[model samples]
Target: MKYIAPPRDAVDPQVFSRMPLAAWRDHAGLIEGRDWPSIEALNAHLPAAARECFVAQTRELLADGLHYERRIAERGEIATRERNWHDLFNALVWLRHPALKRALNARQAAEVARMGPKTRSRAQCALTHFDEAGVIVVASDPALIAPWDAHDWHRLFWRERTAWQDGRAQLEVFGHALLEHALTPGKLLVGKALVFHSTQAMEVVLAHAAAAIAHGELLCDPLELRPLPLSGLPGWHPHSDDEAFHRHAACYQPRRTGRSYPPAVRLGHLGRAALV
Candidate 1:
């Protein structure tokens, strides 16, 4: 991959590593009991005790079932209720991490049940925010916390050119839902996006991810990399109102949350997306 800083000039370089979705979905051990025949075959997931648990919980959360493709294909909106992805390259997340997916649904369901569904309580909002978090960034050194919490986007992406190539960084963006719920949630979460990777990168690893997400979109894109609002993601106005861009981008600092972030998803455990 080539890292080019537009308008000329490079910044401080760093290195980060990543595991693509294919590495997760196609892993022999992981996929052994987790593979599904097709998107329509979600109901026929491999037989396992955990499968029953995930399916039961999934039914409760998504009354209509995880007809992810149908919903997304017909209307192009992922049902926030219960259905998630895998038919497409990015869609394979559900097929890849069933355990994590089950855990997240349980968490999301519990939060909604306790908060009465309509209440946007701080805790409820926090749960959903983390539940639907955008990125999971892991750095070699914990010291990078200070820069991350500071919302250092430009430096991370453009300046730190070698960040991901060398192994100092590894990003897991596609499995946000599973990662958020599988691990603990707390404090303000921030990431150095320059070394970031999107869920769509699974296409490169699997050689069969749908074309929808084949092209790589930079995380440090000044316009698209805005701090996500606490309420929800870009273009998702569930309750109402019109906030076009991320207007509520707040910079995280040591005073508010701890220095080291990205604790929700265990880097060591989940970073096996490497196809090599």
Candidate 2:
């Protein structure tokens, strides 16, 4: 029912990492008590000056609940509005998937309910901030997922591009922030993923991450930017291992350790590893 701006330093660096939504991290501080209302009721709650920011183009965004794909197609462009970063992001998240935000909040609230507000146990902390740190991609078939746990992101994401190209795999980034909150914790949320296939190949994720440590920037050039799909993501594969991933051959190769964190501290009933 209430949200608070976690301190910038306190904000988990790993949270929102590499994800397009990561752009919203800095704006979190601006919207204290982050309880956002439904899109149908959101505008009435905004300040008069802030209300004017929506403009004619985003009337649908402000007035109704539409999935991101539908709203973007209807608006016929990237449906973005810059209302101080927080509101813009709030609107975007709601626009993209209203269910996700609601589900994430409900799940977090349930965790708080179970663990008690003041006590952030390791599991409690992980579950509470699951949206930012945890990511999982669910595909249609078990065969399509084999490469993930085998640490074969190259095949699962890149070499296997044909799977996505043909639209056979049917990947969906789970609205688990809703799925988990509902506690139907299934096989989909079992493990972690390298990156969603739909994500753009932005070097800044690696650039920023690369800048933080020695030799990390060498992992990927800041200049090369485009959606390389699976190969574009950093740390998904052991690019540094030349026998496996040769740098001269890659269009966008990022060399980094191939290690992924679990989607949850404890998956509860969903014990299997997801993307691995």
List per-prediction Cα lDDT, in the order shown: 0.33, 0.35
- Our tally of clashes for model 1 stands at 16
Give lDDT for model 1.
0.33
Tens-digit lDDT track of model 1 for 1-276: 222221111211110111222235343232223232333344344345433312222445456553432333333333332222222222344455443344334444544556654564454343334334444344554444444445453343334425544556555554343322221221123422212222334224222111111121111122222232222221112221223212233422223343333322221222323332
lDDT of 2 by residue, 14-42 (tens): 43432332334443333323343333344
Best-fitting candidate, measured by TM-score? 1
Model 1 residue 20 lDDT score: 27
Model 1 alpha-carbon drift over 4 Å, by segment: 1-39, 43-47, 52-91, 175-276
